[model samples]
Target: MEVVQTIAELRARIKTYRRNNDQTVGFVPTMGFLHDGHASLLQKARSQSGLVVLSIFVNPLQFGPGEDFERYPRNEEQDLAVAEAAGVDIVFMPSVDEMYPTPTRTTVSVSEVTTRLCGASRPGHFDGVATVVSKLFHMVQPDQAFFGLKDAQQVAVIEQMVQDLNLPVEIVPCPTLREKDGLAMSSRNVYLSVEERQQALVLSQSLQQAKTFIDNNVSGSFTSEELQRLVSKHIQTAPLAVIDYVEVLSYPTLEPFEHSHSITTLIVALAVKFGKTRLIDNLILQVRK
Candidate 1:
């Protein structure tokens, strides 16, 4: 796989690909420190697009004041190997300076969807996400951009942005990959101590319990409040797990639903901090009326 650092070089290479064979491109934007979760995205892109482009830049814009921006794990050597093995054609590893150039004058933000979940606690986080993603989308201009659905809220926000702005590329949402123990895979998982890692399983376990709760209540009598409490209580069982948010909202819209019978799709999402590392996991369920 070819790695290019500058937008000029990256665009020039993509231009060559377009001119030579008109190969449709698939883009996967990531913050590096790749794992099977990232590899799953790359594989998805490779299976669909003629050329796969993966960009690894830990976006500082998305990090909050106390968040792990500087300490975020990064291993470019391993990331490149993972990308190549997954059939990535181009890897864009731009410096933050190259991406920002000057202090950014503009940013992208989607409202309502950004008002809850991770967005609520990590203020301005989604704005940073939308801003950087918009920049990458314009730079790559791929036929499709692939993203993992581990951050389903992020996916919803981006999809809303693309629809409202009429961006040309398709946004493909892939499933969240998980470890055998059921913890959702994350780059931050590196920060978990052995005990904390064991505790982190509660995030996914709570999600599973939420799913079962909904399944057993096919009568559709439960409210979002009840579901939230169900998940929150389960996570609390892990003493090390600190609840960030437990929400049961309408699927892509992310609006709260009063009764299970009202919505066709429900998303049960969680963000819990285990010691210093915060982890998120979610399940999307199709409610039967």
Candidate 2:
């Protein structure tokens, strides 16, 4: 796979493939530190598009104050290997200056969807995400873009942004890949200590408990708040897990509803801190009669 750092070179290479209209381009945008989860995205992109492009930029705009920006993991050598193995045709690994040359004056913001969950906690976080992904989407004008469902909110926000902006790209949301032990795969998983890693299983375990509760209550008697509480209580079982938020909201839309009686789809999303490292996980549930 060919690797290019500048947008000009990346575009020049993509243009070669785009000259043939039958060739569809697939794009996966990521912050470095490639993991199995990232690999899953790349694989999906490879399966769908004639050309797969992976861009790794640890966007500083997405990092909030006092967040793990500087200390966030980075290994270009390993990331490139993963990209090449996944059959990525082009890897756009750009420096911060390359992405944002002279301070970004513009921003892309999506409302309502960004007001709750991760968005509520991290102010301007989705703004950074929307902005960076917007920039990348423009740079790599692919037919489709792949994103993992682990960050369901991110997917929703990006989908909304694309729709609102009338961007010509399909957002393909893939399932969240997990470890054998049930811990949802994340680049941040590397930060967990051995013991903390073991305790982290509760995040997934709690989601399972919530799922069971929903399945058992197919009669739609439970309130959204109750489901949130059930998952929150279960995650608390892990001594080291500090709950950020556990929410049950409409899928894709992410707006909270009073009862499960009317909603056909819902998402159980949560964020928890294991020591200094914060991890997020979720499950999309289909409420059935």
* Top candidate, metric TM-score: 1
10 residues in a row with least lDDT, candidate 1: 213-222
**How well is each residue in 1-289 modelled by candidate 1, as lDDT tens digits?**
8999999999999998988876689999999999999999999999999989999999999999999999999998999899989999999999999999899989898999988899999999999999999999999999999999998999999999999999999999999999999989999999999999998888888889888887787586788999899889888999898888888999988998899878899999888998888898999988877
lDDT of 2 by residue, 160-211 (tens): 9999999999999999999998999988999999999999999999899988
Candidate 1, number of clashes: 0
TM-score of every model versus the real structure: 0.98, 0.98
TM-score of 2: 0.98
Shift in Å, residue 22, candidate 1: 2.7
Cα lDDT computed for each candidate against the true fold: 0.92, 0.92
